[model samples]
Target: MKKILFIYFAIISLVLPQSQNESGYAFLKNGFTARNIAMGEFGAVGINDLSALHYNPSYLALNNKTQLAFSHHSLFNDYSSENFGFSFNLFNLPFAIGINTTKIDGIELRTKPGELIAKFNANYFYASLSSAYQIKNFYFGATIKYLYENIYIDDSNGYAFDFGFNYEKFYDNFSLGVVIKNIGNVNELKNIKTKLPLDFQIGINYNYKYDDFEFNPIIGYQNYLTDKISHLHFGTEIKYSQTVSLRLGYVSNYDSKNITTGLGVVFKKFNIDYAYVPIKYGLGDNHILTLIYNF
Candidate 1:
């Protein structure tokens, strides 16, 4: 049974997304909202919603309204997550809070290949507080996060920090953003320490509008410092009358899958978004949905 458990853990370490089989806390690298996922997870720039708290907090300063958001992720291999976010202004500064919980149930525990001994569930969670400040057209932001994970009888906890900057004065309708993420440490689990997935990203986006129609195109580069891996992200969004949207995105340099698509609808102060991603190797597909309310 011990040997089987070890093998299971090794496989999990190799298969989680965006980590390149190099880091722990895979949930941290996953997208926090459906809109961002549908847009190739390109949140390093050109995002003004509460989802910014998970990517580039600098973007949070662009909105003046109080907002609340909730998201659900149905990922491959029985993995699922629920997320919550709240964004508001206090003391003339934009601040946001976010929480994520992930679970994998009915994992088989067996001593050998023949029979099952039992079953267990894995759990992961994180809570974060983020804030941003703006000077002229430049924005700077920071986030503090608390992370926890449990699998079988092993559990660990950690803390991390993220910093980001954005410049919106490039050309008309153009913006640039940069971010550094996962700068912190975690305690050991079962006498073995797990490394964080440190990352750096930069991106540019253009917002074009004519009458009641809008188009946004974005491209970005991401580097996983801990794993020495890199990837490219690109996406576009089309909107009509600010009420309906279509989004398409592509990611490069991944082993499993690359294309993503989604939709959005807005009515008064409420908005909903959905995203779809197809995974290779029969790992199943990913579906994400999010709802937001503004006050």
Candidate 2:
């Protein structure tokens, strides 16, 4: 099984950018879903979908339903990101997988008229496999990922790992979650060696339920091993009739953004989400859309 996974990962890696403008694999920092992005990337708790493969793997065990999720990012029309995720159960244990691809388009070289080398394309790709198991009130999980990038004619490849744990007791309204990500540098560009951005995060959330409405308040802290920087994230979600939700989030210590908001709608087993984020430094704003199906 492991061998098959590695082979599949390799094939996917052949096909696949940045926030904070630092770190070797900065594209990995991009959120995979509008729901998560609107929630300040807070995934320490209250998450139970295939997107968990991009955040806290332990969340996979929270649900047994098979799920498929996809998202698209419109970043000022300069670049775009697409993400796809799937999760299911095997032996009563939950497993999840995902892929992300980012493409930057439209560039012109200063040429007299028309030059064959006037424009080029750049891309980034990520593929991850994750699984989680539960013991009593604790859930533990891990994910292995393959990272690849192509810039003009140069390309690079790398590997990383994510570990996560969640604690949720039955009949409890609160949960705690923790994750360690980008642990190893399996490979990199031959010319210039690089390292993944190692991160450690812990989050907690409390759910308040009454009648058919629900509200969740979340907070999280993230520390970076490579840059020695830390960030605080805050978010809230309000659900009505278990079909509609409104989300708001705030993040501290950022270069070009701080606040995010989103809306979500559920129909039977289908979920649709949208988020709006304003970019600082006059970069305009970002609009993200996500779709999910559970069966």
Question: Where does candidate 1 stray beyond 4 Å?
Answer: 1-21
Top model by TM-score, which number?
1
Number of colliding residue pairs in each model: 0, 1
Clashing pairs in 2: 16-125
132-240 per-residue lDDT for model 2 (tens digits): 9888889998999998887656678878899999898545788899999988773545355565778899988888999999998889999877767799999988999
Candidate 1, 9-52: lDDT as tens digits: 55354323334347778778899888889998778998868998
Reference-based lDDT, residue 238, model 1: 93
RMSD for each model, in Å, please?
2.9, 7.6
After superposing candidate 2 on the true structure, give the runs of residues whose Cα lies further than 4 Å from its correct spot: 1-22, 108-117, 170-172
In order of appearance, the predictions have TM-scores of 0.94, 0.87
Q: In candidate 1, where is summed lDDT lowest over 10 consecutive residues?
A: 11-20
